[model samples]
Target: MTFENTLHFAQQLDRNDPLRSFRDRFLIPQAGGKELIYFCGNSLGLQPKAAREALDRELTVWQHLAVEGWFMRPDQAEDTPWLSIHKRCKDPLAQIVGALPSEVVPMNNLTVNMHLMLTSFYRPAGQRTKILTIGGDFPSDQYALETHIQARGMNPADVLVEIFPREGESAWRGEDICNAIDTHRDTLALVLMSGLHYYTGQVFDMAAIARKALQAGVPVGFDLAHAIGNIPLWLHDWQVDFAFWCSYKYLNSGPGGVSGVFIHQKHHNANLPRLAGWWGYDEDSRFAMTKGFVPMAGADGWQLSTPTVLAMAVHHAALQITAEAGMDALRRKSEQLTAYLEFVLRNSGYPLEIMTPADPAGRGCQLSLLVHQDGKRLFNRLVEQGIIGDWREPDCIRLAPTPLYNTFEEVWHVGQILLKFRT
Candidate 1:
């Protein structure tokens, strides 16, 4: 599997790609009538071409049926009542996240779902009052943990234990993380970590970490925002206590699309504390106008409101695409595509450092570059050239060669553009 930094080579690779046809399923962005090399799927995936049609179908149902859309069966074959449209997403999303269909539910946005899950998992009592998480997590997660602890009358500094990579390293070692869990086993109430770190684009050893935490008598969870569709996961097999992810990124739902949650079957009937709503009540008695709050089983029990039909419509369109392509195939292409990008960058003679781990097992599609100087200028240059990648604060530029839409030729072109910056 030798890679040559030439357009001909890239073109040949694209021609040979089994998943190349997937690129046509998405509507790539254009600037001045030319398609831009879109490598930002880690942030927002390209819209699937089928999204509009799916959305239109939902809109038509609303137009013709009005209020009755909630109950009226559109057809015997389809059976898509608006009241339960969210249920259609469960199987597809379950496939993506490797959970039982009953264990996964497509619901609210990421941060909101995080708060809801925290309510159930982050119960501090006795000496076990601290929440363990990794440093440099997405800011929203940090804020959520801090505020939740404060709301419970605990100081963040006292209850939060954040682990960081040893000095000069960009990613945390698996052993270090496991040892930290052991070190703080006595006071830890919950272990919350990102499945794939947002900033450095490093894939944490989630299974190992989860095992360690569980062994220490702690419940573990993950924020899978960057991990969901971009990587393969076995949440149920991994025995993860809980997890949540947004759909807009590699899942290819539109911006602010619906999020998904996973709660293991072991906890389905535990009667854990939750912030309840009518939508979460047992389905059979939901419309009976009962006074008591009886939650549904599994992840549905965590729902706080009625599903957003339009957003779920968009999500369904995207998850359908993911289901068609399959996660194993997507992951295979991602490794090769990202490895090619790394080869191109290394050979480009730029004084840049790749922050992501070299091992394909330790990352998804993203490659973060630590530019020696003038990082912003270099990022702006790429943008000016219609090479869209993301830039994080100090000196890193993130590019994700999303397997579903991005091609080998585009990865090669990015290298050419990056070399231009070196001059």
Candidate 2:
């Protein structure tokens, strides 16, 4: 599809877009009585207009029912029981991540879930005591891996095989990642990688990476904090061992919303050790409060505490929208939105380098730009213009035009701003 650099053309594309109306459902940000072109979905998504109502309903339930809200009555079939509030997210979360309902459980934040997954999967035995992962990964993931290794009484420098890109390259090459997995396969106890790189917006080949590690007899898992909702996933089909993600960003579930995990049903009954909590005890025997710890079947067994109902309420509302839009539709729109953004930026004559992959399939909605001279000043000018993209340190002006809320016109207008700003 050829793109034209005109407001009329952008507007025409928006008018014909199937997902256009979905934008109206969100509350857009405004500055000085003018709407800002929000390209910061990679950081935080705009609030869903329905989020308020979702919260209010849950608050009312707490007011009216108090402790009774935890139990479901035979009378009101529609009641969202607090005992299983997070369960409402399972099917939608499953559909989003391409996993079976039994394989998904929406619970704690991303880092907490990552810690839990690390506890179960990062079993260091004999000579195979290392974890293979990407270098310059998201800070939280880096910290989690570093601290987890330290907690297990191993020096991170010795136990972590961090695969970094070549000096001139901005992204990790597929073969490079695969080779790294093979290089340390014997000493590697786990292959922990981000499904999509947060800094460069590079989407890793999860299928190939997972296959390589598993074939070499090493366990693998992904941190999908930047991948989920922005791109389509098939964790079940891909046979990914386990994965976790936050519901902010592309998922649009308010700030620090609940996170979820996918554990293949094959491991549901496996005697994998976990950091146990009362909430994860077998449901039937949970109230019995027995002496021994018998975990609930599947991913729910990893849950460490009571569900965050208020946060999950927002997540439930937000996920309902994603489920309704469908991942295939979202992916299509995401590709187009990103491609159009790239086309506009490339043609704008802006002195910036795209740090993300050129191939549409190798990225999600984000396109990170490494600006040239006066980079910080240029970013500030755009912010003053109410063009809301974020500036990451070192050198990155990330613009992520979300499919659910952003439009082609906004992308075109951003190009216009850059073009005029130079003149």
Candidate 3:
């Protein structure tokens, strides 16, 4: 597919995009009566127009039922009990992450869910005490690994093994990661990694990593913070022990929205150690307030507290859009959108180096650019001109042409802006 650096070519691509109509479903941010070209979906996704109605329904329920909203079903509806409202999100979320509905649960924030999952999965014993993770994963995940190890009366320096790329390399090689896992197999209690690196936009081979870790007698987990809605995942088939993701980014729930968790069915009935809460108790006898803790089967057993109904409501709306568009179709568009951006950037003749993998299968919607000089100035200029992409400290600018809202014309315009700034 030849890409042209012209408005007509961009418009032609947009006109032929099957998923183009989905763009209207989102609330695009505007400035001075003009819509900004938003490419920050890697940080926060555009809001779905249906989110307002979804949130309002929950608010209305609260107004009428108050305390009873927890257990009562509305007069008009038979199935949507407030007490089990989060359950409505399970199937759609399961579809997105490639899991059984029972294996997925929408609850808590990303880091908190990581803590909960780590409590159950990261059991260090005898020769197996270390956790292998990427060196510069999202900061919260790094902190979680360190603090969790510390909480268990272990020194993080002794128990945490961080894998880094070879010299002069911006992204990790899948073979290197598997070799690292195998090398430290004896001391590795768990292999924790991000599905898509937040900094470089490199999509790790999660299934291969999981297979390598498990073959070496280690449990593997992924922080799918940047991967969940951005790419297609098959957690169940991959046999991942556990995974967690925030809905606020590619999922587009909202800022600090509820997260989703995936636990393999193999652990559903296991007597795994976990932080206990009433909502995690077996639902049939939950209201009875039983004496002993009998966790509900599957990922629901990992719930720590009552569901955040309002946040989950917004997430539910977002997941509905994801379901309607379908991951396969969304991913197809994402590849084309990202490839177009890459073409434009490479042709702009700017002193920019794309840090993300060149292979389409090895990245998501994001392209992290390593600017040569005055990078921050360039980023600010883009911001001032309403070309919104995020800047990481040091010298990287992250742009994500989100398939749900962003168009090819926007990508072309961004390229023109980059060329203009270079001049």
* lDDT score for candidate 2 against the true structure: 0.91
lDDT by residue (tens digit), candidate 1, 1-423: 999999999999899899999899999899999999999999998999989988888888889888888888566528478788888899888999999998999999999999999999999999999999999899999999999999999999999999999998998899999999999999999999899999999999999999998899999999999999999999999999999999999999999999989999899989798889999889888999879899888888888788888888889989999988999999999999999999999988888999999999999999999997999998999999999999998999999999999999999998898787777
What is the C-alpha local distance difference test score of candidate 1? 0.92
lDDT of 2 by residue, 217-302 (tens): 99889999999999999998888999999999999999999899999888898999889999998888799977989998889888
Point out where model 1 deviates above 4 Å. 75-79
* Per-residue error (Å), model 2, residue 320: 0.5
215, model 1: CA deviation in Å? 0.8
Distance from true position, residue 422, model 1, in Å?
A: 2.4
Model 3 lDDT per residue over 277-348, tens place:
999899889989868898888899888798888898899999999988999999999999999999999888
Residue pairs in candidate 3 whose N, alpha carbon or C atoms collide under 3 angstroms: none
Tell me the TM-score of model 2: 0.98
**Per lDDT, what order, best first?**
3, 1, 2
Clashing pairs in 2: none
The TM-score, computed over Cα atoms with residue i paired to residue i, of candidate 3 is 0.98
Error of 1 at 262 (Å): 0.4
Candidate 3, position 351, lDDT: 89
Cα lDDT computed for each candidate against the true fold: 0.92, 0.91, 0.93
